[model samples]
Target chain A: MDKLTPPVSGSRYSVIRAIIITWMTLVILGAFLLDIPRMNILEHTARNLYFHVPMWFTMMSMVLVSGIYSARHLASGSRITDIRARESARVAAVFGVMGLITGILWAKFTWYSGTSVWWNSDPRQSMAAIQLLIYGAYFFLRTTIDDNEKRGRIAAVYNLIAAATVPFLLYVLPRQMESLHPGADGNPAFSEITAPIMRAVFYPAVIGFIAIAWLLYRQRVRVAILKENLTSD
Target chain B: MRLHSGRTSWLRATVSVFLKDTRIEWRSRFGINLLVLFVLSSVFILVFALGQDTVERNVIAALYWIVIIFAATSSLGRSFISEEEGGTVLLLQTHVPGSAVFAGKLLFNLVLILIANVLASLAFTVFINATIANWPIFVVIVVLGSSGLAGATTILAAIIARTGNGGSLLPVLLLPILMPLLLSVVHAMIAALEPGSSWNDVGNDIATLVAYAGTVVTASVLLFDFVWKD
Candidate 1:
């Protein structure tokens, strides 16, 4: 019998983890402290731009990672690939939930400032909620299969289908509708509306969040691999 | 048995499976009966609940699609469940390719939903008094929406049929995948219901529906082997 090696080494993993933690800490600090010209509707809640948008970026990245791994698992039939695919999807769902919550809060304070409206059926928000349901269904499908290999293959097929649908849900369909979100329905995009100074922090915030998501996903994968090794041996 | 004999074999496999399903369904009439009763009773309940007040087209369109989608989600899971239950899946696995089975099942679901939606729309017109202003666009939407729903649900039906508890999970797995199609169809249906809507109004939506159906069907064919073989 052959033994599987870790994809990333111990020292390299530690170094990456250290960088992600420090980078995320800096992004959070900058999110609050970085000063920009205040606007009427946004006010200080504009700071949410740093937190809310990046969750989506991280979620998209995680979903991309998960889908790629699922494809690889289909091609190679490797247990490790299946583990990575499932773990990354789990992380993607976490970020998707965070993105949805942050988005609701941001919209409530800004778009629905005067009223008691929490949800406006905003297209983007609906899309995010639907995305979360897709992820929930994925996990539920996994639980239904008792055989380990059958679960992996079936779940991988469903994951690919779900991933294929994301673009239509998030980008294609939303753009066709009237969304309060930026860059939809012929509105100016974030780049046009945002100040140049904020871009410095926003871009880094996105990258940092994605890196942190990777770190979380890697930790889970490592733990899963350890458990498999211990049980198999 | 010659699964890889090229386009002719593929088409023959697809047609045979489709014919077999249609023949089985024609004899038993189980799927159609269930779907028709479900659609009729639900619309009856909706009409009774609404109390004869003239509903807005927007509300009518929404309700109409809700019924259609629920009808699909509830019944379409049987596409593969019957095969599993009857213990014929092994025979089919030995004879036809997975892609052909997918194609045939997709065609069956497509025809089934077409009948269901046609009956549903008829019921809508009979009870709800909603007039479709644009016939061409309405027909296009009905066809495209059915294909999209059929394409998306066929593969999912295969997946859930493997699990012992399929009835509860089909909608959970389906609604999200079908969201884009539903949204587009509802929007288009609304436009078609309006007094003077044009194809120009729903051009983008029709395109989206087409793309959604195409993507789902293609992805399903490519990935069906993994689910079907093991």
Candidate 2:
């Protein structure tokens, strides 16, 4: 593997950018154009499976990238690595908020239709709220400190912890509780229930979203590194 | 003067810090007094808020944990900030290992949280007329949940103490980290308070709380060095 292929610090590739944009455009088209069988519950809105689910996967990947940088920052005591961690977390937070907003819209129409409620408080929803707050706390923590090095080190500790708690908050605790979303004790995931024709779009949607998410993180890291350089000088 | 061995001295230093913290707190009575006031006020507010209506076991359980969590958040953060204020942080840092300091503070936090939780729960039982059928499980939940709370508060206090705005950052950072533990404990408490509940009914939640406390305490010990040394 080339050294430039790494997620932390990578050279820009116009080729990859074009591919991701094209792929995501296709996904957007497929999301609306694909023929999904009408369901008793979701009806046409079940098409949201392609968009809403991948948001979380993309956010999780961003968090993983953040944790990797956090661990690297701790081990190496490098400010640049810490910058990567912080930027990655910021990008992850953007995706997480997007995931949440999209979730609310999807649930609003499908689950809580005709009700005035926007926040239905599903188990997954509850845990995601907690997860987001935990990340939000990281940025709050950063604001309370003044020194750049100290802020990075301290926030890196918090970032690591926030990442560590993700599985527990997002998966373990919610899985144990009764919930409307899939992966509960009795209810299998929508993936299992999805039609064969839908799989084509679904797979591409997930891949395309994840690919674009990676690009966003990479760009964010580039800017962050540039900021760090400008500030240090 | 004769010197003690290294291991014994470290243990002695830890115990002494724990006792010294207790002694200072005994004299000031700040945390305990504030905790009592907070707990009593919250319980009174709840009583007035709920009125004479019969509440479900779930609400009672939820309210109980909410009060304990609030009390822990308000009080437990002072452990490290006091040292910071007194300018003894540097003195203590030069003398003890981070693990020893963390252990000492954690011990004090656990005891303090336990005392506050008991006092608050007793107030709840009296004022709110809340009763639990399974006493032992309720006590277990109290112990385990507060242990996790204390663990989180202890570490968070160390982090917050270093910051300029220690007061507000405590809850913002501490509460979310404590959410998983709090969720399980509240769930278990609801089960334990229900009439038909046995240890069997709440076994999973109890296990989760225990694991939470263990994990947080261990993580604190490892992370304390980073937070405290600076």
Candidate 3:
């Protein structure tokens, strides 16, 4: 089987192409419209809402998918399901690294001064780092086991159990602790800002990031299937 | 097909697994003894490094937690490695339900950590000249914190046991997952050590620790069957 293929001329491809074009148009238009004076302070930082938040959103979405696949693999003992879960986890890890980098850039612009530390032990930062570390081990654990079935089951269980800690670390623990990060107890909600026009841009940014993530996920699944078929043949 | 029927049979199977594990662990005390020694030596090193001048109550309390957290990681890493090595995991899998196997292993690790905690606490008190102002609260924190440690470590150890080079991989996998528990325990210990710390001061930390333990234990139990099926 060929590894790559172009889409045939059809309604499905047209619809997909149209959706991508529309998304791109809206993102550009929103950026142009929101660059006006009143919403300009949010310009650079607002750009991050599209990039950074979406990286996190996508990472979380992929991790959730990975966890579900892992559960299914464990319940049914299927190597195919395990392979899908593994691929989802690999993509999640990529998104996680991107999220961290984007978050650091955002933090530098928003929270840091010159000569400040690159990282902080803020509960949110710590917890996010921990979540990354836990999933990092997920891959390590998978590689160490020689038996495919055993490795899948073990990794699946770890994924499901470890996923529980993600919420605690990401949300609960951070909220309980004192931190300089936004969304703390006394901080104003980002969505509650007075700029109506910025919201128009922000919502599209969220959708655009999610769309990009879905595209990446689909590409990964395609690649995995191609590899499976190649090896089987 | 069916492993066993009836609640009593399940309970008996769990106990049998537990006893078998304990007996096996007893025969080869190398891993647990090594863990205890590691804990003791680390406490000594911390005491020396921190020095008499730095021996304030808070610092000592922090050191106490640091020692226990690392010690628990080292101990729990070995909890299942030997079983996997001897093909005993397969044997256990054949005999007991996955849930029972996890329960037996979890209980064994809990008992191991409990001993480690008591011994470490005693060493810490002597070496750091620290005294627990609230004995009950101190014990409560140790139990809750160690239980959380055991729960997280048991699942992780099981996951890494069959992996190549899992010896070092265990701590890499464990520390991040146990951070919340570590933080809560440290806070609780500080409150317990403070002369003026009231129950109100330590209450939140204690509650958080208990919640973590409960959540991890319940999650491990529900998910262990899925993990062990392989």
- Which has the greatest lDDT? 1
* Candidate rank order under lDDT: 1, 2, 3
Task: Give Cα distance to truth, residue B28, candidate 2, Å.
Answer: 1.2
TM per prediction? 0.94, 0.93, 0.88
lDDT of 1 by residue, B1-230 (tens): 33444455788999989999999999999999999999999999989988878999989999999999889877788989899989999988878888999999999999989988899989999998888788899899999999989988899999998785876789989888888888889989999999789888898889889999999999999999988987
Pairs with steric clashes in candidate 1:
none
Winning candidate number (DockQ): 1
DockQ of each: 0.71, 0.58, 0.61
Which stretches in model 3 have alpha-carbon errors above 4 Å?
A1-14, A25-29, A36-46, A170-172, B1-8, B56-59
Top model by TM-score, which number? 1
**What digit string (tens of lDDT, one per residue) describes model 3 on residues A1-233?**
23333223478855875797699687877775556333433445755665666677777788888999988987787666787788888877887788788777766766664647677666755665776897787887777877766877888888888877666665446635677544676666765653666666767776776676666666666676667666654
Off by over 4 Å in 2: A1-12, A170-172, B1-8
Candidate 3's error at B64, in angstroms?
2.4
Please, what are the lDDT tens digits per residue for candidate 3 over residues B1-230? Answer: 22453444767777777787788778988658877898889988887787776467667777787777777777778767878777777777777777887777888888888888888878887876788888888888998888888889888777666677766887777877777777778877888888877888878778788888899989998877665654
Pairs that clash in candidate 3: A144-B163, A144-B164
> Of models 2 and 3, which has the larger lDDT?
2
> How far in Å is the alpha carbon of B6 misplaced in model 2?
4.3
Give the TM-score comparing model 1 with the true structure, all chains together.
0.94
Model 1: residues with Cα > 4 Å off, grouped in runs: A1-9, A170-172, A186-188, B1-8
